[model samples]
Target: MKKLSFSLLAMLGFFAIVFVSCKDDDNGDPAPLTPTIASITPSSGPVGTSVTIAGTNFGDSPSVSFGTTSATVASGSTATSITTTVPAGLSAGDVNVTVTAGGETSAASTFEVTEGTAPDVTTVVDTVVALEDLSSLETAVVAAGLDDDLAGDGPFTIFAPNNEAFDSLIANLDVADLTAVVAALGGANALAGVLQAHVVADSLPADLIAAQDYPTLNAASTITITVEGDNVFANGAQVIGEQIIADNGVIHVIDSVINVEAPAVDPGEPNVVRVVASPDGLGAAETNWTADNTYILDGFIFVNDGQTLNIEAGTIIKGRPGQAARASALIVAAGGTINATGTAADPIIFTGEADDLNGSVPDDANALWGGVIILGNAPTNNNDVGGVKSVEGVPTEEGRGQYGGTDATENSGTFTYVSIRHGGSLIGANNEINGLTLGGVGSGTTINNVEIWSNLDDGIELFGGTVNVSNLVVSYSGDDGIDIDEGYTGNIQKAVVWHTGSTIISTDPRGMELDGGDGPNETAMPFTTPNLANITLFYDDVDGSNLTDAFVMRDNYGGSLYNSIAFNHDAPIDLERLTTLGESSYDRYTAGDIVISGNILFNINGVTDAANFADLFEISNEGDAALETEVETALAAANMVVDPGFGTGATKFTPTADAVTDLDSDDDGTDDELPEGVQNLGYKGAVDPAATEPYFANWTKTWAVISQ
Candidate 1:
C-alpha cells in the first residue's frame, strides 16, 4: 500500500509539470497597455485651430476624437504627442478630447472651444503673423519695413508665400536662412519692392482674379491670376492654403515666391536700358526705332490709334520677365501700324532680356515675356456689339485691346525677315500669348521670311485674319506649330516645322491645330478655309506617352492641304467634331468643302497601317478607292522611300535630286494637278530639291537661330 501511494504522488507531479508547459505555450505574448492622454496645448480656439495633444503609448497612426467630432491629425504624430486641427461645426463649450492608438483607447482631456468670428476684424499683417506657416513671410515683411503699410491698408490682396516657399528660395539662392535671403535681395529696399509686387490695392478673390489683371504696388509689375484644373495659381505660384479674410484685405498662401528679380544686366552693354511703359497704353506719337540701341520693353506697350512705330533693320527688342498683367509686348492697336521691315542679313530680333546675344540662352528657354500682338479691323465670326471682340491674353476691360470689324481689307503692318524667340507668357487659364498674334489682320499686310523659335505657345496664331504668310519656320514651340482659329481665310506657303513636341507641362501639342469657330458655331460664315501648300512637318523622337498629333481639325473647318509631307508623327490626324456641332470634318470632306490631297505621309508611326493610309481618315467609303489610289500615286511619284538629306542648320532643308523628280506625274518633278490657290513648286515638300530657290535656305539662314 505504501509503494502504490508513492507511485500516485509521482504521477500527479508529472501531470502538474505537463499542465504548466501547455499553459506557457498557449499564452505566447503579452498584450499592450492602453494609451493615456496627459494634456493638450492652449485648449483650443475654434474651427481650423491647430492643437497639440500630449499622451503616452500613442502608436504610429493614432485616432483622436474631440467629443463626438473627429480631429484631423496634421503631422509630427509620435507616441508622446499628436498634432491635430479642431474640426468645424462644433459648438462653443468645453469638450472631451480622447486618443486611440493600436486599437486601444485613452482617457478624455478637457478642451475649451471659443467663438468663431468673421476675419474682417483682423488686418492682413496681423493675419499673416498669426499663422505659423507664414512666419518666414512675416519676417520678410518686417525686415522690409512694410508691416505698417499692410496693417493700415484700406484694402489689399496679399499673396503670402509660406515657410516652405522661403526655404526653397533660400536653397535656390544657396543661402543659409531667412536672414541670408533678405540680405541676398540687396537689402531692405529691394525686398520691399518684391513684397509690394505681391500686394494689390483691390481685394481680389479667386473668381475675380481669374477675370482681370490687377495692378500691384510695384510700379513696374502686376499680378496675373490663372486657374488651371481645380487650383488657382498666381504668377505660376500655386495657392496652397485656404484664403484668410481680414478687415482690410485677404491673405492667400502661396507655395512659391512671386516676382523674383531677374538676372542683372551689364552696365557696359551698349544701348541697354530698362524702359517701363505705362499700364494705360502708349501714346500715338511716331516713334522710330534705330538699329544702334537695344530696346527693353518692361510692360505692355500698346501703340495707340494713329501711331506708326517704325523699326529699322537689325533692331533688337528685349522683353523683361514679368507677370501676365505686366508682360512686355509691342501691341499695335486699331489704326496703328508697325513697319518692322528687316532684311535677311540684318533681321529684326525679338527675344527675352535674359538672352545676352552671345548664345548664352538655350533654344528651349521660353516664356520669359510676352510676344507681339497686332490687332486690326478685319471681319471675324464671333463679334461683339460693334463687330468687335476682345482678344485673348489681354485685359477684356481694356477697350483699345478689342479687335475685329467689318473691314476685310484692313491693313495692319509689315513683318519681314523677323525672328521672334522665347516669348509667349501665360495670361490666364490655358491662355498664353503666341509668338506672333495676328488678330483680324487684313490681306494688305505683308508677312514673309518669319522665324519663330522656342516660343512658349503657338509659333504663329491667326485669329480671323485674311493675311497671307510665306517662308515661315517654327521650331520648338511649346504648343502647336501653327494655330488658325475663328474665320481665318489666310494662305500659308513654304512653311517648315521641325522638332515638334509638347512642352514639359503642356496638355496638347500638334503640328497644326485648326478650329473653325468657338462652340456650336460650326457653320460660321467664311469658315476657316486656309490654303496651305508646300509644308513640311518633322517630328521629334518623342515617346508614345506624349500627346502629340500631326493635325487636329475640329468644328466646320474647310481647308486645303497640298504638296505637304507629314513625317513620323504619333497620330497623323485627329478629327474631333462634337455631335452637337451638326457638321463634321468627314461631312465637309464629302461635300468637297475640305480638301486633303497631294500630301505625302512618310514613316508614319503610332497606331496606323502604312499600307492603307486611307484608314487613318474618318471619311466614308464613297470615294475611298479614288482617294487611296491618289495617295499611292503621289507616294510613288514623289519617291517617298528616298532620304531627304536634312542638315543641322537653318539652311539644311535641301532634298536630294531623286526626291524632287516625280516618276508618275510629269517626271520633270512637278505635280500633275495643282490646287487653285497653291503654286507648283515642282517639289513634294517645302524645300525645292531641284536646287532652285529653296524656301528655308533663302529666307531663314541669315538671322534665324537655327543650331546655336
Candidate 2:
C-alpha cells in the first residue's frame, strides 16, 4: 500500500465507503431458511394430545407428520413454533414429527405416543377444538351454543364431520363459508337443529354402533345408523377412522355432515323470516315439507287424489287459527298419499301457529288449530249418494274431500309417530274437527304410535273403513277419546285414553263413543265392530261432577273389548237400545257380536250403585231381565273391581306386577282372542308391565298433567 496524494486518497476512500454501503444493502432477504425443530412439548402423549413444536421458519400452510401418520396442525401456529395433535391410527410407540413449509422440509423431532386404556381427561369441546379437521364443527358448536353443553358432563356421542365435508356442504349450498351456510339454512336456530342432529345424548362407541335408529339431542330428531360390512354410516355419512374417546363423550368422525330432514323454524316469532305457506290450489302436487322450516296451513290444505304430501321427521306444521271454511287442516283425499312417517325420537308435530315447541303450552291448550284428515277408498254405509260423503271438517264444494269407494283394501300412506296437538277447530255448527279423522280409511293404510292431545273435539274418529290402529295415546280431549261410525270395522290395540277431568270441556266427553253406523243405516252390513284390546281408559272427576262415561255404545254398535281397563268414571259401560233399528247394541251384545270381557273397572263412580254395569245404562234389557243378568254375570265372572296398582301421574297406566299377574290370570284364550293385527299380550291395559321401556314413555307430552 503506497501513500498517495490527498485528493486521490479521498476518492479511493469514497469508493471503499460506496462499496461497503452497496454490500450492506445487497444482503437481500436472508437465504430462504429451512424450517428447523428445536424441541417438542411433553415429549410423550396419547393420540389426540396437543403437542407444541418449538421450531423456526414454519411458513403459512405448513403440514406436519408424526412418523407415517399425518398430524393435524392446530391454529395459533407461527414461524417460530407449530402446534399439532397426535393423530389416530398410529402405533403406541416413539415416533418422529416433521414439518414442511415454504417448499422446505424440517428435521424430525422425537415424540412418544402413550396410548392407554383411557385417554386424557378432555371434554367433547376440547377434543373438537384440538382437531384441525373439526374446525368448522367447533365453530358450529359454538355458534349453536352447544359448546358449553358438550363440555359439561354429558357422556354424549358426537358424530363429527371433517373439514372437507363442511367444504362440500358449503359447495353444495352454493355458499362461501360456514356463516353463509348458517344464513342459507335460515338462522342460528335452524343451524343449531342441524348440528344437534349429529349429537346423541349417550356415549355410544363404534363397537356398539349397530344398524338402528338413535335419538339425538335435537328435539324430535334422530340419526339412523346403518352398518354395511365393517363400515358404519350415520344418515348415509360414513364413519371414518377410529373413534376419538374424550372424558365426557366419544367422537366418531364422519365423512359428511348428517343431513337433517328439516331444521327447526320459529313460527311463533313475530314477522318470521321464513314461513312456507300452502300451495295455491285444491290439489297439491307431490311435495316435501322438510324439517328445516316451519309450514303454515292458511286453510284446508288438501293432498288431492293421486297427489302426495311427504312430511319429514321432526317437522312442525302450524295451522292458522280459523273456523268454518277458513279452518286449517291437512286432508289426504282418496287415492292421495301422505307419507308422514316419523321415528320415536322425531315425531311429526301438528300445532297452532302460536306454539313455540318449547313446552310452554298448558295442559288445557285446545282448539288452537285444526287436525289431520285422512280418507281412502273403502266401503261406507253413510247412505249418501254413491255411499261417498265429504269429510266432516272439509267443505263439500271441494270434490277431493269426498271419500268412500268399492275398494276395501285401499291405502292412504303411512302415518306413524305423529302428534296432533291443540287441534279440532270448529269447522261447522256442532262440527268441530277431530284431532285425527279417518274417513273410510282402508286396512292397507298404517296408523300407529299416534298421540292426540288437547283437542276441542274427539281425539280420533273413524267413519267406516277397516284401518287398524295401535299404540295410540289420546289425552285431554274435550269430547270423546275415540269415535266410530258409518260401519267402521277395524281393530284398535294398545290404546290409552285420558280425560283431564276438567269442567271446561265440551259436553259428553266420553272415553269411547262407538256406533254401528250413521243415522238410519244403524243395521248396515260390516257394522262398526272394532276388535279392541289392551285399552286403558281413565276418566277423572271434574269439580265433583262425575258425568263422564267410559264406554257409550249406541246406534247398534258391535265391537269386542278384552283385557281392557276403565277407571275413575261415573258410567263405565252403557249400551244403547235403538228400538227403531231391529238390532241394538244391547241386542248385538246378546247375539255375541259385541263382546266385553276380561276387563278391569276400578273405583267406578266412587263405588256407588250407579257404578253397576247394567244400571249405568238405564236401558230396558229388551223386556228380558235375563239379558241384564247376563251382563252382570259376565262382569262378576272375569272382570275385576280392585285397584290396578298403576303408577301415579304420567305413568298412570303402568300397572304393577301384582296387577299384571291378576290380568294375566283372567286372559283365557276362550273369549279374549286377539285379532290378526293386535298383539296377544297376556296382561292388559295398553302396557306390558314387564317392558323396560313403555311405549308411551318417551314420545308423549303432558302425560302427568293430562287433566290439570
Candidate 3:
C-alpha cells in the first residue's frame, strides 16, 4: 500500500512539473510587431528608377513584398524601408505594396504602375501641331507661322492670355485670328518681334525680377518696377496665373491679354524708390521726412537677406501682386525690420495690388506678383539615400531645413498690424514657395498680428524655421493654410482658417518634412514637432483631394493638437495612405504615426464602407477606438459651417453669426489664456506652454491670393 501511494505522488509531481513548463513556454517569447509597407514616391515610375519606400517595422525587414513580387535588400536593412525594381507585367495604377520582416508579413500600401511619362498636351501646342479644327485659339496659332517656332528647340517663356482676356481685346482691336493680326502688322517675323518683346529670354523668375529693372527679349525696352504692393508687372500688364511647363519652355498666363505699348517712362526716372513703410507715429529717434513719391507696403517687405525695413500703424500700404508685399508677408530672415504699428481707429490696411484690366485703364499684367522671400543662411535636407552626389530635381547641398546661425539675434523683424494679400504660387518644377515662407528662420524672429488674404499655396509654409507666429488669419488658399516642413520647431496658435482646403496640412511623413529628401524611410528621418491650439480649421473640399483639411499628416512627425475643430474633409479623416511602405518591425513605426485628440470632425461626405476606406480605418484604428472618432465628430458638428461668408461685398473671414472662436483672442490683445487642459499654446521645443495669447483682429477676413 505504501509503495502504491508513493507511485501516485511521483506521478502527480511529474504532472505539476509539465504544467509549469508549458506555462513558461507560452510566455517566454515576446509578441512580434507586425510591420507593413506604406508608400512609394513617384506614385508611378518606370522600373529602373530607384524608389523610396516609407513604412513601419522596417527595422525588421528581411525582405519586402510587392504583390507576388519579392526583393532582397542590397543595403539599408531597415525593416520599415526597402528599394526594389518593378517587375515587367505589373498593370498600370496602384498595386498592393507590402513588405516582410521579423518573420512577419505587413499590411500593403498602394503602388502606382508606370506610365511612359507625364501627359504632354496643351491648348497652344495641340492647336499648332495637331491642327485641331476646334478651339479658336488653336486656329489662330496655325494662322500664325509661329507654330513651328513654338515646336522649335530652344526653351522660351510665353506669356499666354486666355480666350476671354483676348476676347475683351477683340472688341477694341479689329482682328479675326492671330494670323490676321500678325499679317496686318507685317508678317511672321513682325509677330515674332512682338512676341520677343514680351518673352523673357532667360528664366527670369518673379523673385529675380522683384530685385531690379529687367530687360526682356526686346533689346531696348526695360520694365521699371515700383513695388507698392507685392505685384509683378510686365510693361504694366497684370500677369495672372498658370505655368504651362513643358520640357522645352514655360508659359505665364496674363489677364486682359497683351498689347505692345510705349514704356511707362521714356528714360525711367532716377530709380529712387521711396519705401514709405513707416506709420504716422514717429519718435524723436525717427524723422518724418516727407517725400513726393511713396511706395506704401501693405505687409512686411523683405528685399535681400541682409536688409531692414521699418513700419508703423495707419500705414495705408498697398497689397500688389507686383511690388506691394502679400498680406502677412514677413521678411523673417536676411535681417530685416518691419515696424508696423496700427491703432483701432486707423488700423494698418493692406489692399491687393490688382489693376483695372478693363479698357477703362491701361494696367500692367504682371501687376500683382507675390510675397517676399528672405534667403537666410541655413541648411536644407535634400539628399538621396545611397549617399549619392546629388538629387535629381532639388538643389544639391541645400542641406536639410535647419536653424542655428551665428547671430542668434538675426532680426527678421516684427509685424504687429500687418496684412498681406494675394500671395504664393508655383516657383518651379516642384519648386514653388508659399505665402509667408520663413526660410531657415530662427526662433528670435518676431512675428505677430499678421493676416494673409487669398494665397495660391499654403497661407504660411514654415521651411525649417524657428519663428513663432500667432494671430494668423488665412482666407482662401489654393492648398494647405499652414504647413511646417523641414523641422520647423516653431509655435503657431490662435489661427483660424475657413476655406475649402486643408488647415494644418502635412505632406510626406513630416508634418515637418525632413531636411534630407530621403532618409532610411519615415522612421529614420529626423523631424521636430511644433505646438498648436485654439484653432478652427473649416475644410469643405473632400474627395481625398488636398483642397481642404483641418490637417493632413504626410511623411513627417511630432506635435500636439488641442481644442481644435475639423469639419467636412470630404473623405476619411486621414489622407495618409493607411500602410507603411518600407518594412515592418519593432524598431520603426508605420507611416500613419500620429496622436490625435480633443478635436471634432464632421462627415458631410457619405460614411465609409466595409471593403474600402472604412476598412483601412478599421485596420489602423484597431482595438475599438470609437471614443476618439466620437470626439472628432462632435467637434465638427459644433464648429464646422458652410459658406464661410465669402459673399460679393462682405467676403472672407466675415465673422459668422455665432462663432466664439472669433472672440477667442479679441480681448486679451497681447496675451489670451486657454482653458485648463489646453496647456502648450504653440509648437514648443520640448516645453510646456504657460499661457495663451489673444488672436489678431479680423481673423476671418478674405485676403487676396494668386488665383487670377
Candidate 4:
C-alpha cells in the first residue's frame, strides 16, 4: 500500500510539473497596457477641478498630469475612463494633459487654463516683450530708448523685425548677437535712428499701407508698403507673422530689418534732370538723353513724327509717381524711332524716381511710375480709322498713341539689354500700362535680353505685333509675365518667367496670358499662334494667394508649347474654352494645329492620372490599335521626369546631360520646327546643359536687374 501511495504521489507531482510548464509556455505575466486619453471633459478649468478623461487600455492606478503638475486619479477608474482632479498652483495658459498607466504614457492634448476675467490693456512694448520671437527686437528697442515712445497712446505702425531677422542682420554684419548689433550701430543716437525708421506716426492697416508711401520717424525717409497677392511687405521685407494689436498701435512682424539710407550717387554723373514737358510735348531736337545725365519724366514725353529719341547705354531714366492724368510715360509714336540699343555690359534702364540709381531697388516699389510705350505700324485685328486703334493706357485725345498699319515687318527701332522697373502706372480704372508695351512692333525690331522686374502691370505686352523676342526674363510682375493680345503672331524662345505668387493689385498673375482677340470674331486671321519654345516658369506657391497658372490660353488662342519645363505650379497648363468666344485650346490641339511635346511637369498640384492631358494629343491617324499604342507611348514620354538642376546663383538652371537629351528630342508637326533665330540645341529648357558655353551668360550675368 505504501509503494502504491508513493507511486501515486510521483504521478501527481509529474502532472503538476507538466501543468506549470504549459502555463509558462502559453502565457507570461499580462502585457502592460498603454493608457489613452480620448476625450477630456470641459477641456479647461481652474486648479482642483474634477475632470473626466475617457479612452481605452487604461490599467489600474493611472496617474494624470496637467502640463507638468501631477493630478489625483479618483477611484472607480476603468480601462476606458478615468476621473482626475486638476493639480494646484497651475498657471493660466495652455497646458498639455497626459496620462500614464502600467509603465506606459499616452499622447497629450492641450488644455487651457482660463483667467475668466477681462485682462488689462496691453501696450506695443508689452506685446513685443511677451512674444518669444520678438525678445531680441525688444532688447534693441529698450537700448535705443524708444520704449516710452512706442508705449505711448499716440497710434503708430511699427514694422517689427523678429529674432530671425536680427540674427540674419547680425550674421550679415559679422557680429555675434544683439549686443554686437547695438555696438555696430556706433552709438545710441545712430541706433535710435535705425529703430525710428521702422516706425510710422499713423496707424496704417494693410490696405492703407499699400495705397501710398508713408513717412516714418526717420528724417527725409519713407517706407514703401506693398501688397503682393495676399501678402503685405514693408520696403522689401515680407511680413512673416500676424499683426499684433496693442492699445496704442499695431506691430507687423517682418523677416528682415529695414535700413533707410540715401542711395549713393556718382560724383561725375550730372544732377537729375526733371523733364517736365508742355501740353504739346518736348520737341524732337531736345530728345537726346545721354548716359552722363539722369532724365526724369514729370509728364507725358512723346517722340513725335519724323523724330528719333537717341538714348545712350547705361543711361538711367526715371518717371515721377502719379496716376490718371498725372501719369508719366515715354511714348514712341507710329513713325517715331527710339535708338535705345544698349550692350550686354552697359544696359539702359528705365525706373521710378524712388530708385536712387543704386543697383538695388525694393521689390515692392511698383506702380510708382509709368512704363515705356513703343508704337509701330504693324497689322492688327481690330482696326479703326486708317487701320489703327487707340492704345489702352493712353488718353483718347492722344492721336500719336494709336498704333496699326498694313506693314508686317516695320521696325520700331532697337530695344535690347534694357531693364524696365517699377512701371505699370494706372491711367484709368482697370487700365494700367505694361512694362514694355510693343504696340504693333514689327518683325524688323530687335528685342532681346530684356528684363522686366516688379512692374505693376504685365511684364511685356505685345498688341498685334510680329516682333519675335529672345532671352527675356520677367520677375514679380503684377500681371502676366508675357501677354500676347489682338492676334499677335510672334515667336518667343528662351524665356524665363519667375512669377512669384500674385501681383500687388492684380491677383491673376500668369507665366503667359495668351488671348486671340476681344471679339465676336474669335477666329481672327493670325489666331494669336506664337511658336513658344524652351520656356521655364517658376511659380511660387503662396498660401491663401490667388491661383497663378503657368499658362492661361483662352479666346481661341492656339500656340505651340515645346521642350518646356514648368515646376511647382498649381496648374501647369490651364485651358479655358469660352463658348461665347468660340473654339478652345483643346479644339486646336485635336486639329493638330497646336503642338505640345517633350514637356515635363514636376511637383504640379492636382495631377493624379499620368494620362491627364492625353486627350489633347492625336494618338492615331489610322486604326484603334494604332491609337491605343500611340496614346500610351506619347503619355509616357510627355510626363517623364527630368530634373533641371536649379541652383542659387546665375547658373541656376543648368540641367544634367541626361535630362537635356531626354528633353530635347521633340520634332513633330509644323514645318517651322524651331523659331527663326532659335537653334535646335538638342536640349530642353532655356539653358543647354551639355554646351561648353553657358546659357544667358552674356545677357543675364551681371547687367540684368533680376540677376543683381
- Give the best candidate by TM-score: 1
Per-residue CA lDDT of candidate 1, range 387-409, in tens?
46788777677776788887888
TM for every model, in the order presented, reads: 0.64, 0.59, 0.47, 0.59
- Least well predicted 10-residue stretch by lDDT in candidate 1: 118-127
Off by over 4 Å in 2: 1-284, 608-626, 657-659, 663-672, 703-708
Which of 1 and 4 is the better model by lDDT?
Answer: 1
Cα displacement (angstroms), candidate 3, residue 375, comes to 6.1
Q: What's the ranking of the predictions by lDDT, best on top?
A: 2, 1, 4, 3
Best by lDDT: 2
Give stretches of model 3 more than 4 Å off: 1-259, 266-307, 316-332, 335-338, 342-367, 374-411, 501-526, 540-548, 575-595, 604-708
**Candidate 1, residue 84: lDDT:** 92
lDDT of 2 by residue, 1-708 (tens): 355687799999999999999999798565666899999998998778998888788987788988656778888898888888888654455778888887788888889877722212211211122222235555656654555555433323322122211211222132334444445545545333234323333333333222112222334444455544433444454433333211111122322223332333334655332322344434447788878777777677878787888889988888765445446788887888999988888888888765666644445666666899999999888774667988887766678788887788999999999988888766544667899999999999999999998887899999999898999999888888998888888899999988866622566778888888777677777677888988998776756655467887888888888888887887646777656567888878878888776677776655533245455333444445665566767655656666777886555678774655454444454433455566668786987878865686666664435322
Inter-residue clash pairs, candidate 1: none
Q: Which of the two, 2 or 3, has more TM-score?
A: 2
User: Residue by residue across 253-273, what tens digits does model 4's lDDT show?
Assistant: 322223322223343455667
Ten-residue region with minimum lDDT total, candidate 2: 119-128
Score residue 495 of candidate 3 by CA lDDT.
72
Residue 633, candidate 1: C-alpha displacement in angstroms: 12
lDDT of each: 0.64, 0.68, 0.41, 0.63
On a 0 to 100 scale, what is the lDDT of residue 77 in model 4? 90
